[model samples]
Target: MPIYQLGQINTAALQTPGLYVQVVPPRTRIINGVPTDVYGQVGVASWGPVNSATLVGSPTDAQNFFGVQQVRKYDLATAIAIGLQLGAANQRIVRVTDGTDVAASVALKDTLGTPVTGATLTAIYTGTVGNTLQATITAGTQQNTFKLTILRPNFTPEVFDGISGSGATFWANLVSAVNNGLSGIRGPSQLAVATIGTSITAPNTTNTYTFAGGTDGAGGVTDSTLVGVDGTSTARKGMYALRGTGVQVLNLVDLTDSTQWPNISTFASGEGVYGFTQGPVGASYSTVSTSLNTAGVDDWHMKVLVGDWVYWNDTVNTQNRLLAPATFLAAQCAAQAPHVSTLNKRLGNITGTQRVAQNQPYSGAEIGAIVGARLDVISNPSPGGSYYAGQTGRNSSSDPTRNGDNYTRMTNFLALTLASAFGYVIGQNQTMDLRREAKSAIESFLLTLQQQKMIGDVNGGPAFSVQLNAENNPDARVAAGYMQADVQVKYLSVIFYFLVNLEGGQTVTVQVSSKPR
Candidate 1:
């Protein structure tokens, strides 16, 4: 085609083995050098698809995929809303239904104690929230006309009117009507994987359909549920559903629950997934801060935000201080890709966004950092308000070599992400070209990070460097089909304290002093 369209063309065809000519533009590969901004969230939504992950890009997507705020059901929805409001531009939510692979569904029943035949109504999801649903059938003005009302949680009653059961499109239209919702209903969905049929005749008598058998297992979510029991089984639901979902971070919002957060965090870390979580909601801010600022079981593969203040709607904004941290951290990470530190920053400000102060309602010792438990909330001099002041989960307990500061974790995550991508690209390359290509890719990635100030600026210096070549991959090892990459990272430090002493009102000028005078 090119030969026929152009007078002359110099192309790769008929070229020597060592050289070629081409006109195609080079394809640039752009990938997140750190954990991608995509957030993988797992929650027990009162209404929405269950046991599967649904992609949600906006607040509306969140509402459509998961139910709106219910006093007992906002475990997932609230965090997602806060994340979006803060900065999560892309996200996915996994609505957990029951322990194991069980689906906690509700079924409509008839007067005879048996499930009604035809026009079956199942909640869009399987959970206790299904109990809130109320479906009713009533008479219409015209003959053979019937009105179907679906009263869903947090949504207006959906009334399907002027139904002619005689038409062939009856079942399809009825399903469509239920799916699209009536005038007032929008978010709280009635049909999760629910279905309705055409076999039932028009209602000559009024009947109300109610569902039963929804359950929240006493054991919380079982271990096998979050991380699939095995590879092939869909029984491993929730976070496991995020496998091919393209999310680099999995934010489990409830750190206090001791059920979902710990299990999900362990799974994420084991799979090289990076994310953030809120401090364990203890009795006070001190305990929460201590849990986050120090390390033990709850601190690996993810960072912890140690504050109990968040902004939701003003009416009961202060009601939930623990739920917003994962979202706040997620938003910040998304906005400043790989810059996961949200310390000393304000989260949200709109009327929909409420400002929650630290949990230091009684003692200000930890708040002012007088006790020096990592970083605590002090008055924000620049912003004229208060904000969190620490961005790390590292403490005296964690390893100093691999993770030492907030920036160090981000750096490691960036390097690892780049390395993962490099491995894939190199797998396609010839064995002989592995070292050269891998080195170049890694070097370019680190260079970009340095230029963007996402990581510390250490040259081939002891602080930061990546080495891959013949030295690390010897001819013997190359022959054995082995590849290795050596990486070292060190982050810069900040001065958090400066002691100033006034000795007996001396007349000496207090100017430019790093020493204790």
Candidate 2:
């Protein structure tokens, strides 16, 4: 007998086989759950590429990429800082601009006795942060040569040396050095780009140049800019840039335009993103609720907040700033597990809210109006009391069944997880074994979710059931290359009210057991 492995030979034709060791691989696949904590924030910033998604891990990372929080509207860094403060990590930040941004530039003069222009250096990114860049030219160790040093705050200086040339050649060499960079000594300049103008002689001493005329272009930014275009991959803009970034939760920093709610809701629905938005700053509950209703913002995927814009200590800007409720609510929701509801969860790093700062809390009627509108808010003296927490974690849905934060988020989480894990089964052979394997994979995932308490039993019944067999995939459907799966999951509900029934002392008899009472 010859040694053989599974799939290497047909066993029925192996009449001369010596030792057949067939290794059968496991067919049942384990579906891993997708992360529900990554957050996506889209807004204006002082620095960073526009319409591009960049992952930032901490407040410092956000500042490093997008600049520090500014005392202006539509500030992306401020929103990211707020999210980080509330324990949200793994954020995808996308910057937006008004399309009027200009890069900072400076002209170096040629040593033509009268000193004609030699080269112009411009920042690569179009923002005011480029204005802070400084370039210096100093005599190099090689005779009649110069060294170029580019500097920016909180970054390593890029230096290019060993310059030697004449006339236009000198400027070309310098430009090439800054643009194409040296092979080993240094890489391309991160602060600026250089274009050759005219040649210059080596400076006798050091001279520093500061960039000017850079514009942030944030002044003219409107709601449309933040909503952005979902053009082709290379032309995608604003929040659309976050596509395929796997950001489970998202928000447009301080976006209050009621007209764009449907657009954002559509994007969220299509992208499987759970989004947060807020009413206008200092807007009354009636105004917010009416505006939401009129705007047709009733999607379970979008959570709209009201009456909880907070006064945050803007330590970066050294001022008190009013932040949107979505900033805190979205971050808290992103930080939580998918099954955990945002209801009554304490907010972090908040100084005061509009209600708290004004010594005004929502009355029963006001809360009723807000909840009746299916909007959520962060306020003090919540069910948790004293500390600020999400007071009624409702999404903007008229349907009461899908209004809860847990319902929306858990559904998205489970659905996305299944969709993400089941794609591998598409091209497999249409056999009962394949169907069984697919069924087992889905059942295994649901079992994991149930064991983790993400889903739960209802009245002693199983938390979920999945059907992916010949019964669901009948002869007609299977002949047409259609495989069907029927799944039903019971999500654990949030406890909005804990009611107690009490009987009169004189009429009721109390029973006590010695075990604990």
Candidate 3:
């Protein structure tokens, strides 16, 4: 028996009697739920490919990809570290710079007659992390040859052995070894690259050289650098680098520019992401509310935290630094399911806040005012308990009906899941069978979500309803190349306010009832 591949074949043409089998695709596509915990951050970093989205799942991964977090503003690694501390499992970080970064470099002198500069070795990536790299030149095991060793902190040393030549030829051989690789010993150097100098002699001395003059270029980094450009796939920069990176929650590290919140909101809406932003550090609650109101930043996809920068233990720099709350909030929210609300949920890894560190927590009036303004706040004593937790789950949306974090997350999750899952149905002919198949796929997926309690039944009706019959998808519309699947989903509401009715005074009557067996 011969098995045939997928295609339209004439079975009648097969004259020979044989058992032929052809595998047909599934009648309906299977719809899998998209992940809701991939956090994306764009900020400055010590070392890494700039304008690229790199996956860093833990602090160790982040340290390896972006170097250690520096004690400075807009540190991408630090934000990632904090997020990891707060249970951010999956993260895609994009490093940005101010265009003035310089790679770490060192000069190696020629060992013949005159010990002039023979070649210059430069770090492959720009940042202060490159300064930790060291290059050593020593005698090789082979006769009339030299060996070069490159060492970096926490990494195995790379050794290029048996480099033989004289003057410029010798330098050229060394540079080629570092840039490319030896035949079988190792791959190309990951730390630095070498450039040969003109009219030089061979390096014949054993000397260890330290790299220097590496700049992170963070001082000149501006808001535009963080927002980035989406010119093209090859030229995307900053947050744009995170496009289509499967990021459910997005944050710009410690960005506090309210002027750009609108732009971020728009991006989040288009990308099906929940964006986290912050107000200015130490700004009063009234000020933040006024600023947001005036800017008209009432976006359902945007969550604006205000007036509560917290002091986090920056173990990387051995200091307690005051940082914005957006990164931490974004990570915590991303760790949760789409239907879960962050309101009253305890946030971890917080030492102190601007309000609490000064012995001034948000008063009841202040909390009410801030929440009323459609902004979120984090405090030590929240309604849930005494541990640090979100005061409210409000997004920047002015509409009260669409303001909760749960609403934004659940909406994005459903919309994006449907959008991704239904693309396979686009080219299929509009028939009752096709419509039924699509409807079945969608209902099965939604039923799973309902069983998981991501959505729930409302008013004795189903949690969701799908309409794909001729009534909704008219013959004229189907003939005009339009196939529609009308869907209505009822998202579970969050309990923001709990009402308790109590009457226990002497004037109140108490009744005893029989208990169930």
Candidate 4:
């Protein structure tokens, strides 16, 4: 018998009674534990690099990298706040700007009203904010030294002190001064880096220097324009550009309206391409579901679809408003992850009241949880609230599991880890030694899950089983290069109801007979 690739074979990869996979996305590396604080957030910046995923450390760093929040037509400030709330302590986020406009730098003219020969003040980025900036050159205490002060919106005067007279370092000096001054202040600035040619630095008697002809250019500014970049440019555009960045476990938080939703399915089918979505979908479950289906994808097409219509403490508005359909779902996940990190736990309902979350309806107030095939969150409402934390995974209506990504990810994680390990350690040999090594690894991993109370043999039987022996590896099949691993996990679903009947005044206490008539 000739050997066949795992996909080419028709027989069960492993003849177990549980779960297994015929094909696994190719994965080369397998690190045991998961990673946190790694997030990709895209939105508009008043000033900063565009389409580039620059890692930032703090809110100040965020302001430095992407400029202050300018309240664009489309905003993601809410997501940023939520991620921060969920443990942004040591996390470094990849910050990106959706803006594609050009920098507005124009010539600084001389005292005679003529254009200065050498330097021009360019706002560190492109946008209308640059138009609001004006630079003034004033004399210094020293003979040739001078100070250039930049007036900006909602900012104190940024005084670029100690500039030299010679035209040699004027541009460099100005750029350095602007950056230094900007950093010292908390408010972000449109004035960042600069370039200048030969310029007469003779201190002007009038403190203000004249600059002219600065325009933001005709570029996309609205929500669609911000997210519509096709990523053809090397720097790329919007979230589409971030598809291949290898920024693992994205959590796929959408801050830019709902535009971040549709294209996530297109993030390239890579083995490690795993993440979750907190669709700030400003609409209802049906709406989000309809959109995903119409786009030819389900909530579980490639990621977990967690439905939430509310987010806490609007960073921009400072109002704890409902997320409409759902927007801050990512934040909710982040806030609640410590309780259960995508384990087979249900979110039930975070809101403390029955049929309410955050003082709103327990879930959506109308529905208990989301219906149909996708995985969703809702308030159980019986004991106040508990997000139906039992079932978690992004599954479609056609899927019987009905669980969200928790279980699926477990199976996938184990399967892929095993598959990759087997491929690397065993090579092409389909022998008994190969089967033993694979089985050991699978059992060890499963045991760890059981110990953690994640999964187990609750029924006094194997909650899960792995099979990879002579039966699966027939004499005809072993030669072709296929080793089957039929593994199954008995996921424990959350019990929503427990029935008990009470016949009026019936008591079992010993005192009941003495009190009876």
Kindly list the per-residue Cα lDDT of model 3 for residues 1-517, writing each as its tens digit: 7777645557768788778898777777678988999999999988888899999997778987789877878888889888888888899999999999889999888765666777788998999999999988888889988889999889889999988887778888888989887778788888888887764566747778889999888899987789988778889998889889889899998888878877788789989999998888888777888888877788899998986898889876899999888877888999999998888888878888998988998888888888888889888898867889888888889888899999999999988888888776677667787888899999999999888988886555789999999898777997899988899888888998889998888888898789953
Cα lDDT tens digits, model 2, 155-215, are 7788898776766787788899999897786888877889877554544244678898898
Higher-scoring candidate on lDDT, 2 or 4: 2
Task: Look at candidate 3 and tell me the lDDT of residue 71.
Answer: 80
**Between prediction 1 and prediction 4, which has the larger lDDT?**
1
Q: Mind giving the per-residue lDDT tens digits that candidate 1 earns over 164-254?
A: 5643345445555666643453422445434664344333245666666655441365333434332543655667777666566666545
The whole-model C-alpha lDDT of candidate 1 against the native structure comes to: 0.53
lDDT of each: 0.53, 0.85, 0.86, 0.49
Q: Indicate the residue-level lDDT of 124 in model 2.
A: 85
Residue runs of model 1 more than 4 Å from their true location after superposition = 1-35, 98-118, 127-233, 238-240, 243-250, 257-265, 275-300, 304-335, 349-385, 388-397, 401-405, 423-434, 456-466, 487-517
| lDDT score, candidate 4 | 0.49
What CA RMSD would you report for each candidate? Answer: 8.0, 3.1, 2.7, 11.5
The top-ranked prediction according to lDDT is 3
**Candidate 2 global Cα RMSD:** 3.1
Those runs of model 3 whose alpha carbons end farther than 4 Å from true positions after fitting are: 1-7, 10-20, 116-119, 140-146, 162-170, 199-201, 458-460, 506-517
